[model samples]
Target: MSILFQAYPLARAALFSMDAETAHEVTLSTLQRAYDCGVTRKLMHEQPETPTTLMGLTLRNPVGLAAGLDKNGAHIDALGNLGFGFVEVGTVTPRAQPGNPKPRIFRLPRAQALINRLGFNNLGLETFIANVQRSQWRQQGGILGLNIGKNADTPIERAADDYVLGLAGVYPHADYVTVNISSPNTKNLRALQGEDELAALLAQLRDKRAELADQHQRHVPLLVKIAPDLTDAQIDAIADLLPRHGIDGVIATNTTLSRDAVTGLPHAEEAGGLSGPPVHELSLGVIAKLRQRMGTDYPIIGVGGIVSGKQAREKIAAGANAVQVYTGLIYRGPALVSECVQAIRGM
Candidate 1:
């Protein structure tokens, strides 16, 4: 086995032993330190290959660090040099708030999955935008996408205001912006997925996009991130609504609240969304549904349960223009990035 693969179990064990949130902070800090000391520069230079483009943005490769990993835009530069094609930061809300009490994040090592009810805990939109503005990676031409959301206390009816505010705040600095409407932790948030609500949200965002384009003299793509638990009817509604509202793309899934695959695991009953192997089929199904509804030409970014090159290929075949990895990155390490990129190249 490669050194990376060998080290993964040890690293995972160490991280898993700590409180999940604390371990996440420690990992981010370590990455930031490595980035500051130029360790990431050497790693990137010595790694497999150079850059590529996706969604009209220049990416160093196709392997992107998904949102929820760096909720507040911390570690963008650090993560960028770790060889991700792009980095998505935040499910940043309009206001900062402590998420659900302790034990919000759970791990099912046997299934290589994570369940997090992080409740959109973030540094808030202002801090998030400032961090992105100050990012060395953004200044250095790295592709960064901002994932935006409403404050936890914000009622579902007025969620569009939060999205619009976030979009406006991040527009000047982001390569593209993602509207995250799928997180299960937020009460009634997924209701936005309904045909009428989703149509209204997209229409509002499209109007904002036009205004931003005119104001900034550039067009920024707006991608909608959905939940894997949606029914065919809901997915069909989304597919039908997307083009009508000029939505740029679709992120096939967020995490799932179902525990279908890890039913007996110790933490399987946790009240957050589950991601990893258990989410594979559902996420793929969502991707396939979106692909069929939107057609091959529409861009679809598949995410969830992608632990290996083969899985990534399956997502591509299922019809993802690009794929994002989170839990898989936790289980597989940086090596999985190159592995999946190579796999996509072969395809």
Candidate 2:
């Protein structure tokens, strides 16, 4: 058995005893420390590697650690060591800012779910790039994705400026840069996904990317992260716009503001995007719809509510090029990474 699974119950017990956000911080810090100390390397069992290529980048596997787990890119190597085929960090802004107030993160243990309104909290792009540069993974040729977002205080009308700046800043560091327009916690950020707005925003970003690619002499793929609450009409619009806008891929979900899946559960009404098992069906449906609309080859990175190997496989069957885990990692620990890799490989 993998080391994380063998020791999960104990680690979970200790983690669960603390409040959700505290537990999250402690876990991240500990993982970073463990990884830095070379302790994780010893504890980890031999990982069977699986390679999959997507977006012109050859990943060691199809499983990846989604953004929000490491907003500042502080733990890339540690997470990379856990055997994810790729790792995405941040929803970082142009400047560091404390996100929404405390109690912003709530755990609904009964649902294996979490509601978080952290509004793109990170140590800004410079600090994020610093961490990225410090990672041994960068030199080792690991696949890394950088997720970018506007600061919460930035008005929706001027959001593109932040995105444009963020895109330019992170272009060199990212194997791909995910434009996070669907995070519900950010005020009207989801509005960017509207057909007209999305087209305009993407048009601007695309032009900027062309200039950057010429200057840097490398084209970093761009992907857009969308919300799960979208209707069929909205999903179809996004699919149509993706290729037109020169967008490389799309992450079918950010999270759901809908509590329909977790109604009556504690913290069910907590304000934020709901993630974990509760979002599984919703995210899967979006992936399926996007695949049907986008046709065979468009890359879709599936995420939301994936808590096991079976769910991970379901994502691919629905047409995801690869799958990412955020809440699944919180609920299942690092073992989820390998389990998902094996499951996807089995397919």
Candidate 3:
């Protein structure tokens, strides 16, 4: 184990004492410094190569760092060194905008979860792509997924325009692109998941992908990220639409709007999406349903509330071809990545 991984318990204690977002920024900066000083090199020997292929891309392992942790695509090299098979960045928009007000991120220690209304707050496309372009992650044999979202100000009806724009901008650089219609923070963003809205959006994205694929001379698989708060019928409807629209795969979940598991905990009533242990079952349930509906061959990347090696294995058993993590990394640190990779490797 790396010294950093061994020190995480102590590091997490100090980070946990600060505001969630500030601690997040500090961690990123700290990672950059660690990378620059070659401290992250200590972690290299910790990675166990368990090559897995998903959506035509070969991953070093099935464990990935989920989107939203590095929203601007900055810190890709530092984060990739943490032992993820892939690192997905963004939930970025076409234009830059401040997200919701402060006190937006609350940590619930009792439940081991977080409530965040940070609302796709990112530095926008140009800067995001620039940062992505500067990264050596892909060159270093890591899969890179770029997650795109609509601007909060973008009218929900015209949302395709923003996604189409995002697709074009990131196509040349992405190993895969994720259309994030799942985040609960954006007003009416989830509305896009409705049958009619999703149909229209996918249709447009399909057409755009064809054009971009032809232009780039390479096809980048497009995937969709959905929320865990869906009904059985809603899941059925989405499963029916994905392949028809040329979506290469599905990311089983984002975060949840449900607080059922953490009803009495602090910040349980917070208005954003709930992640960590509280949403684990919900994410697993969604993945199982989607796998049942889409059949065994369809690709499904599971993510939500995975904080342990056993939970990562459960995601695979429940039908996730691969898995990703975010809140778990916040609570468990870099060691969680290798734990998950080792667990999934055994399967």
Predicted candidate 1, C-alpha RMSD: 1.7
TM-scores for candidates 1 onward, in order: 0.96, 0.97, 0.99
Tens-digit per-residue lDDT, 84-200, candidate 2: 878899989999999998889998888888999988888898999899888877667678999999998889999999999999999988899999999999899999989999999
lDDT of each: 0.86, 0.89, 0.93
- Of the two candidates 1 and 3, the one with more favorable TM-score, higher being better, is 3
Tell me the tens digit of each residue's lDDT in model 3 across 166-225: 999999999999999999999999999999899999999999999999998999999999
Off by over 4 Å in 2: 42-45
Rank list by TM-score:
3, 2, 1
Candidate 3 residue spans exceeding 4 A from truth: none
What order do you get sorting by lDDT, best first? Answer: 3, 2, 1
Name the weakest run of 10 consecutive residues (lDDT summed) in model 3. Answer: 40-49
Candidate 2 TM-score versus the reference: 0.97
Q: How far is candidate 3 from the true structure (C-alpha RMSD, Å)?
A: 0.9
User: Residue 268 CA error for candidate 1 (Å)?
Assistant: 0.6
